[model samples]
Target: MSIIMQYIFNGIFDIYSIQSNYYFFLTNLQLTIIVTCTLWALCMGYG
Candidate 1:
């Protein structure tokens, strides 16, 4: 039970860290560009 709790805690911590880093590195403009590029790629790939 304790191990399971630790695993869950670690997962939450990892997600928080990842999200923090993502926001820290990418500004609004960069995020918009990235999302646009990703969507364009997906559209091109699938359609």
Candidate 2:
């Protein structure tokens, strides 16, 4: 579980680091929002 979280965070940071344009930034922002919602739902379900 810790490893999975680490991997997800790393992926998020990597995506942020690679963003170099407005379009890419907007897409990444959308992706981040989606991932955040999914993680929140999983936590609420498990908690």
Candidate 3:
């Protein structure tokens, strides 16, 4: 039960924090695309 709660908490954390290191050069539109793509992938992966 604790493990499951931790997993849920981690998933919530992932949704809040994007993988930020690689896309520093991206413009706002490009960053929005990357973030939306990541978020969509995360939703699909979690669901």
Name the candidate, 2 or 3, with the larger TM-score value. 2
- What is the C-alpha local distance difference test score of each model? 0.94, 0.91, 0.81
Model 1 backbone overlap count: 0
lDDT of 1: 0.94
Model 1 TM-score relative to the real fold: 0.55
User: In what order do the candidates fall by TM-score, top score first?
Assistant: 2, 1, 3
Please give the lDDT score at residue 21 for candidate 3.
35
* Predicted model with the maximum TM-score: 2
Residue-level lDDT of model 3, residues 1-47, one tens digit each, is 99999999999888656655334545666989999999999999999
- How does residue 4 of candidate 2 score in lDDT? 100
If the candidates were sorted by their lDDT against the true structure, best first, what order would they fall in? Answer: 1, 2, 3
- lDDT, residue 29, candidate 2: 97
Per-residue lDDT of candidate 2, residues 1-47 (tens digit): 99999999999988877765667879999999999999999999999
Pairs clashing within candidate 1: none
Residue 30's lDDT in candidate 1: 93
Kindly report which residue pairs in candidate 2 clash with one another.
Answer: none
> Which of the predicted structures, 1 or 2, would earn the higher lDDT when compared with the native?
1
